[model samples]
Target: MRRSKNRGFGIALGVAIGTSVGVAVNQVAVSIAIGIVVGLIFGSILDKRSQQQEK
Candidate 1:
């Protein structure tokens, strides 16, 4: 979707942040998992809103 054009950036940013935090806490795996989940939730919200607007 045009409105969700930055989805990849959003997800990547989320993962990066999560990994950074995980590194700080020495929980790389858990932090990455949480980050990815959060990123997906955020990206989905953006995508849905964009689609709704299209309608």
Candidate 2:
């Protein structure tokens, strides 16, 4: 449950960052897509680390 929350937060943060990058590059759509993928990856990494700590 806690891991899921972290993932959600990561996704939101990624979107925010993606939006900004998109604006800078004038590619909102592409940036958002990339952001989502990156966010998911980051979220999973975080989840793994947290799990390790818990153990």
Candidate 3:
């Protein structure tokens, strides 16, 4: 449960960061693209961390 929550938080954080970066850069397409990339990166990081913790 806590792990799930952390993952969600990480995703949300990624999206927020991506959106902010997009807005700052002044491009909607770039913002959405960045958001997805950031989300994936966050997800991967979280997955790796979880695996490490499990080991």
TM-score per model over all chains: 0.69, 0.89, 0.64
Q: How many backbone collisions does model 3 have?
A: 0
The TM-score between candidate 1 and the true structure equals 0.69
Please state the error at residue 23 of candidate 3 in Å. Answer: 1.6
User: What TM-score does structure 3 among the candidates reach?
Assistant: 0.64
- The CA lDDT of each predicted structure is 0.80, 0.88, 0.75
Per-residue CA lDDT of candidate 1, range 1-55, in tens? Answer: 5545656656777899999999999999998888888777777778888788879
lDDT of 3 by residue, 1-55 (tens): 7566666777678778878777887886777676767776777788788889999
Cα misplacement distance, residue 23 of candidate 1 (Å): 1.3
Ranking by TM-score: 2, 1, 3
Q: Clashing residue pairs in candidate 2, if any?
A: none
Model 2, 1-55: lDDT tens digits are: 8888878878888888999999999999998998888888889989998999999
TM-score of 2: 0.89
In terms of TM-score, the best-performing candidate is 2
TM-score pick, better of 1 and 3: 1
